[model samples]
Target chain A: MTTSQNRSAFLSGMLAMLPVTPGIIPFAMISGMAALDAGMSPLTAQLYSVFVFAGASQIAAAQLITSHAEPLVIILTIWIINLRFVMYSASMSSKLPPSSIPKALQAYVMTDQSFAICAGMFDQNQVPYENRAMFYLGSSVIMWLIWQMATGVGIAFGSIIPTSWSLDFGVWLCFIAIMIPGLKDFPAIIAALVGGSLALALHGLPFNLGLVIASVVGIACGYLTEKKLSSNLPVKSDNDAKERFQ
Target chain B: MSLPTLWFVILAGSLGTFLARYSFFWLSGRKALPEEWIRILRFVPPAVLAALIVPGVIAPGLETENPLFNPRIIAALIAITIAWKSKNVMATFAFGMGALWLLQYVETLL
Candidate 1:
């Protein structure tokens, strides 16, 4: 691809991500405010946004910190929550060419939005394979900057926001927003309901292990449900059902 | 958690997360994850988020007393409706927070 073509691809990738930006602002703000509420200094809060860059995991970490959970629990929870990235990376690897960018840097900026945009564009042949790296960079870099700035704003104004407003609930609301969209199918609904109820039932478990156990149960429930459903239907390749879960 | 412990968690968490993100790229020769794994992994997000969210709304902090009257539960009910109907993140927050504040105000009057 010519330099001009690469630039255009990059610009288009960035522009495509514009619609997703507003949705992310609340999450970024929540992360920042949660961090401060959890007793982290403004600098450390901002640093979390900078270093972690994944909003859900950052919020989970902040919540665990504030609740005085063990450090191992906190770390394990964050890692488990982020395990989806393994699937994302694997799905993206075949599409993204080697040597397009440094592996470490590429991994650093690989986010849900960026991965979605790039993968969508590539699948639709909107961006050529050779130019995908440029496209990925364009989308991810802007998102990184926006996340940092939004988190900074949230940190600056977190204390000013009154407790009467009950913005702390916004944290759970954010998770609800993320979760509801994923409940498009029966198994997903079952996973969420079972997982949630199990967590509630076992909430008193020491060290917050209930969350981990519930997650395991929920995944198991969903997997079994999917297997049962698929078995009843005609056999299909795994790829055909891949999009069903996501 | 202590300062050093928090720092260690952050650093270690970051390392683990980055490795997960980098694994496929480093193992490009292996191709994608097995189909079974992908199918199972698909449940992770919803499961984890539900596990995290439910307790917060219902038995927040694992309180032993009645949780039915919790403002968060009512607000979450509203939030889930908005999330399902609107599918707008901002709308979910606005309606959820508005519901929580209103519920809290009502409790104060009682």
Candidate 2:
């Protein structure tokens, strides 16, 4: 691609993600507030936004921090939560140009929003493979900048807000917002129910291991349920079910 | 956690997350991930969120004696309803926080 074409593609990618900014603002703000409530310094909170970049995991990590969970457990939880990115990466690998973009840059910029935008573009053949890197860079860079700035503003705003306001509730609200959307299928619903129940039952586990155990059990139950359901179905209908699950 | 420990967690977490993101691209020449693995991974998001949110709602603190009939649980139910109906994050936040504040207020009144 020529320089101007690359620039335009990048610009267009940024514009495409513009509408998502409004939704992201509240999330970034809540994350900042939660970090502060979790006893993180403003710098560390901002750094969390910079390094973690994933909202849900950051919130989970902040909650763990507040409870004084061990660092290893915190890291493991965040990693487990982020394993979805591997799926995103796999899906994007075929669409991204093989030889041009460095793996590091691609990995650094990989995010749910950018991947969604790029995946749509790939589906439409809107951008050529050569320009996919520029497109992704544009989209992800804009998102990254906005998230950082939003988190910074939130941290500043959070520090001034009195504890009487009880903004900490925003964190759990954010989690609820995220979780409700993913309850689309039977397996997903079962997974959530099992996970939630186990989390509650094992809430007294030392070092906050209950959350980890619950997550494992939930995923296992969901996977097994999906497997059993798929196995019992006829061949043609099984394919349809698999597609729906995907 | 100490400052160093916090930094270590952030760094280690970032590294692990990045590896997950980089896996397919870095190993493009290798065999693809199994279909079963992909299907299983689909459950991770909801499951993880559930595990996290359940405790936050039912037993926010380790010392909480009662897990039910709390402000957080009530507010969370309201938030879930809004989210399910509207799928709007902002709406969920508004309703959830409003319900929480109102519940706390009523508790104080009684």
Candidate 3:
């Protein structure tokens, strides 16, 4: 792709993430308030926002702290809630081209919103190989900025936002909006159904392990289904997917 | 939840999270992921998304009680259709939130 095309890819990356911003604002605000309610100094709250940037886990940690949960329990809970990131990282690493941006920075900026957007783009080959990293960076950096700002707003103004708005649900809507496009195939459909069903059945599990278990089992189910379906077909190599990214 | 302990948790949590995010990238390094693994990973986004979205709508706040009466179910179904057909985020949010607010409003009257 030309420089102009790569530039457009970056712009598109940012544009794609824009819709998810509304969903994130309320959550970040809540994270901010939760930190304060847990008795962290404002500086430490901001530090929490900066260091452990994962929203769902951030709030979970705050609640854990407020309840005087053990430090190990808090870390373990956040880690469990975030194990899905390891899967995303496994997937994203393959899509990522070499970059001057440190791997540390890349990992730090990575979020579910960025992962979903970049995953869709790379899988569809809508962005060229040279532009994939740039595109991913574009989406992730914007989200990092937005998250920090939203947390700051939350910290500055506590409980001011009404629950009546149900803005939290926007988070799910954003995921659904991006995810619907990927459901055009059978394996994807199976994955979603099994995953959704298992999550509901196992939602009672401790520390949100249900999500982790559901995701793994659902992926395995989808994988096995795909394997069985494609048994008669020729084996497709990783290069084919890599070529698509190119 | 002492002062030092809170800071320690923040530091420790930060370290753990970064590891989770960085795990595969660090291990895989320059190697291309195996084909089998790639195939499995293809389902990651879909499965995870469903796992997240389904609970948020059906159970809302992780409440495990029977959602037989929850309006969120109806709102989510409408949103999913709009998301699939229109492929427009704004349209999904507008109609989804509108359906939800409308349903909740009607519920209050009854």
Best by lDDT: 1
TM-score of each: 0.91, 0.89, 0.69
Model 1 Cα lDDT, one tens digit per residue, A82-162? 988888777777787655578778888888777766776677888877778788878888888888999999999988988
- Fraction of native contacts in model 3? 0.63
**Docking quality class, candidate 2:** medium
Model 3's C-alpha root-mean-square deviation from the true structure amounts to: 5.5
- Between candidates 2 and 3, which one is better according to DockQ? 2
Q: What is the lDDT of candidate 2?
A: 0.80
Q: Which candidate is the best by TM-score?
A: 1
Cα error, residue A216 of model 1, in Å, equals 1.1
C-alpha RMSD of candidate 1 = 2.9
The top-ranked prediction according to DockQ is: 1
TM-score of chain B of 3: 0.66
Q: Write the per-residue lDDT of candidate 3 for residues A1-246, one digit (tens) a residue.
A: 567876786777888788667767766776888898799888889989999999877876786688676687677767755665776777788788887668888888898778876787788888878888878988888899889998998788765757797655655665676567667668878988998899888876766666678878888898888887875544332222222211
For each of the candidates, the C-alpha root-mean-square deviation to the true structure, in angstroms, is 2.9, 3.7, 5.5
Candidate 1 runs further than 4 Å off: A232-246, B61-68
Please give the TM-score that candidate 2 achieves against the real structure.
0.89
